[model samples]
Target chain A: MAPVVERAREVRYATAAELPEAIVGADVLFAYDFFSSAIPDAWPAADALEWIHVASTGVDAILSPELRASDVVLTNSRGVFDEAIAEYVLGQVLSFAKDLPRSWELQQARRWVHRESERVAGTSALVIGTGQIGRAIARLLRAAGIRVSGSGRRARTDDPDFGTVTAQEDLHEALAGADWVVCIAPLTEATRGMLDGAAFRAMADHARLINVGRGESVVTDDLVTALREGAIAGAALDVLDTEPLPDDHPLWDLPDVRITPHNSGDFVGWRDALVRVFTDNFARWVDEEPLRDVVDTSLGYVPTDGSAR
Target chain B: MAPVVERAREVRYATAAELPEAIVGADVLFAYDFFSSAIPDAWPAADALEWIHVASTGVDAILSPELRASDVVLTNSRGVFDEAIAEYVLGQVLSFAKDLPRSWELQQARRWVHRESERVAGTSALVIGTGQIGRAIARLLRAAGIRVSGSGRRARTDDPDFGTVTAQEDLHEALAGADWVVCIAPLTEATRGMLDGAAFRAMADHARLINVGRGESVVTDDLVTALREGAIAGAALDVLDTEPLPDDHPLWDLPDVRITPHNSGDFVGWRDALVRVFTDNFARWVDEEPLRDVVDTSLGYVPTDGSAR
Candidate 1:
């Protein structure tokens, strides 16, 4: 915000109840933490709103019916998360394969337990969603010698990064033989609650699931049941249906589950990088030029056309 | 042992005290935990020992003065541990970079802290030892997009795995800017206690050290002091000078040190793989053919000549 203030633009910062008055004369709105519904509640006062930029990849929270019906240009920060999230996925995968959690447990007990671990090389990974984040995960995992397969909304056979991407309908078959099932798909009607009890049953008994995408994409109750029943080996979740995971959440107490505070894509200097992306896009917006990372509002994300504009 | 018993050969299993009588007419001796020094004590009674195979990569335990003076061939299970140990190194590297240890600590406290992590890609790693195990670590770390440099007994510029292998004389120079210092060198008189207090002080403040090769290669007292004073960030030690690390050891109580019971090279099926190496060599011995993984006993490990044999 200080950097934006230095740009000689009048910026109005307001609370949820004060947003309506602040948005009355604003031509552009920067929705930081767009997951909050305060922006939509103040939508009627956005009379001069020409563009709305979200500081996140997922726009499900800010996608109001009125905004979708309006002519306001919607944009998101897309490429900012690729490498960071990919590193998180690899970290969790290696942790499970090497049993680092158990190693820590033994360390705390002062027990010098010698246990044989599993190797990551030659193991199979089924990465759901072939977007920039998913492709990044596949690339890094492949480098570590994991046999990577991807699944997207439509089957893609020509992707060099994710070999022979299976169609979304065939996800179950892909799940059967995979040693890891990583979900990085965007949240949408088609993807919500996609990983239910049946999906868990389709996965190998020794397979582990990693969710770095939206929490709504997985059925939390079903995951708990699967973990309790020993249907899958374990799960490492960076996102959940509820933020902070609620202090009383059963997921926190589960021995087979590892919870991270929805921070998979965060790295040092992330805020500066996010600000840079927005400021660069803001420059183009002010000059009446086509903006970069323009989200396709109909699809709720930027289309994979390999374009920055 | 079951496979050897089923080979239709006369086999006598005995304790270290009884090994002399058992070795009277034995053509082959399988020293499965030869570190006990009992084999050397019973060496006088081995009248017909032609070959001895140690079920581990390190030949230090069985490198007795009498054995070195004798004509008996010595071999070790080399290739079996290369991949498993490499995986272990990578797991620790990723764990440190991603702050998984801190994440686990937060989980235990039920604290949902969102801390930014460091990126592994584009980071620098200095891997000591250019043998098969070191090469394997370099290969995997390189695959994960780390800038990997290696050190060996003598500098070699033609190596493909590590760009330019640094000589042992310049190891401290190699440690100056490295984000990770991985010691996978064999245990030899020249390499023992190579990583001392001075070496730790030369490392970057945020650098982490991983020792999977041998405990004696690093000075444990110096490492503990370094960790206490924050000379280096942390360390993950799979090999310690003492096996089972004694319950009262100070290393066990250090928060910055991660201790595993010298099991970095251990993986599921490792024992079976060791037996396979021995049984395969046994067939060669029976046919009067050269054995595989013949250790250059003078050097304490197999000399890397780019050959599987």
Candidate 2:
């Protein structure tokens, strides 16, 4: 925000209610966190709004019907979270493979338990998305010697990162052999509640699921049931259907579930990075040149051209 | 053992006390665990012993005075543990970098705490050994985007893994900027008790120490004091001064210290791999071919020619 205040031609700071008045003449809208029900009510006032930029990769929260129907350009901070989210996924994978939680449990009890651990080198992972974040996760996992396959909306036979990118329709087949299933796909009408009870049942009994995507991508109740019934070994979810999960949420107390507030891709100075991404895009917006990370508002994400598959 | 029993001209099985009688007519000795206090007493009876092989990497446990002075060849299972130990070290480093323990604590209390995590890339590590295990650790860490400097018995300027390997004498200088200090050097008179109070003091307050080398390489009491006083952030010790880590040891209860019972390198099927390493050498021995992983007994381990540096 400081960077933008100093660099932008004009910066107007206003609350949700004040946004309707403020949007009357603004050309660019930088929706930081975009958490306002007032956004739609204020949408009629954005008469001169030429572009809308979100500080987050997920634009669903800010994608009002009016805005979606408008000719205004939509862009997001896509590449910014790539490496951080990749590292988080890798960290969780290694934690599960090395059994770090068990080690801690033994440490607390003053026990010296020596158990043979699984090797990550020859293990396999089925990454559920072929976006930048998922690609980054695949790259890092491969770098550590894991066998990685990716799944996208469509099947790809020529992917260099993942030799054959599995189609979303064939995800269950991939899940059966995967030691890890990482979800980093974007949230959209098509993807919401995609990982349901059937998906969980398809996964190997020893396989672990990691959700760093959106909470709605998984059916929370089904996940709880899967973990309780041991249909899958465990899960590490950074995102949940509800933010600040309710005190009585069964997922919170499950021994096999590791819950982290949706901060997987966040590192120190992330806000600064987010601002930098927008500022760079803003410079392009001012120049009327093509912007980076422009999203297809209808798809609710920056559609991959199957290049990174 | 199954492979050896099938291939050997004669396979003799005996307890430590019975070893003296069994070893009299044996040409090769496969010391499985080699736990006998009677090995030195039985040395005189091994008139026909031409070679000795141990199932474990560290030969210090089986390197008896009489055996070292004898003409018998000695070898160890070196390459077997390289990848496993490297993965263990990387897992621990990621655990610390991601603050997984804090996340777990927050989860246990059903708190959705969001905290910024540190990035592993662009961080520095000072690996305190240049041997196979140390090099493996450095390689894995570097793969994960860390700037790694290695330390060995002597300074190496031509090492490819590390630009300029620091000598053991200058470890303190390396420790100053390191986020991770991994000790995987062999247990030798010079390396024993190398990481003392002064060494801990030289590290950054947030840096962690990972010891997968040998327990005696660190002064247990100094490590306890350092961890207790927060001189160092934490430690993941696979090796401690005591095996099975006496239930009453303070290290067991230290919040920051993660203790694994010296099994960091013990992966499933490790025994089979160890035997394969020995059996491959045995085949070479039977054919009058030179053996692999031959140890220079006078130096107490495989003498590196600075080739791996």
Candidate closest to the true structure, highest TM-score: 1
Which residue window of length 10 is worst by lDDT in model 1 chain B? B2-11
The DockQ assigned to candidate 1 is 0.76
TM-score of chain A of each: 0.96, 0.94
Cα lDDT listed for each candidate: 0.86, 0.85
lDDT of 2 by residue, B68-133 (tens): 788999888777888888899988888787788889888888888889987888889898878777
Over all chains combined, what TM-score does candidate 1 have?
Answer: 0.96
Candidate 1 stretches greater than 4 Å from native: A2-5, A15-17, A34-36, A305-309, B2-9, B34-36, B306-309
In model 1, what is the error at residue B213, expressed in angstroms?
A: 0.9
TM-score of each: 0.96, 0.94
Q: What tens-digit string does per-residue lDDT give for candidate 2 at A1-309?
A: 655445757778878878999889988888876443466778888889888888888877777878788898888888778888888888888888888888888888888888998888998999988888888888889989999998888887788777778888887888888989999888888789989999999999999999999899999999999999999999999999899899889998887788888888888878989898888887787777999888898988898653431
TM-score of the second chain in each model? 0.96, 0.94
lDDT of 1 by residue, A197-269 (tens): 9999999999999999999999999999999999999999999988888878888878868998888888887
Q: Give the per-residue lDDT of model 1 (tens digit) for B5-72.
A: 45757777887878878889887788885443678888888899888888888888888889888899
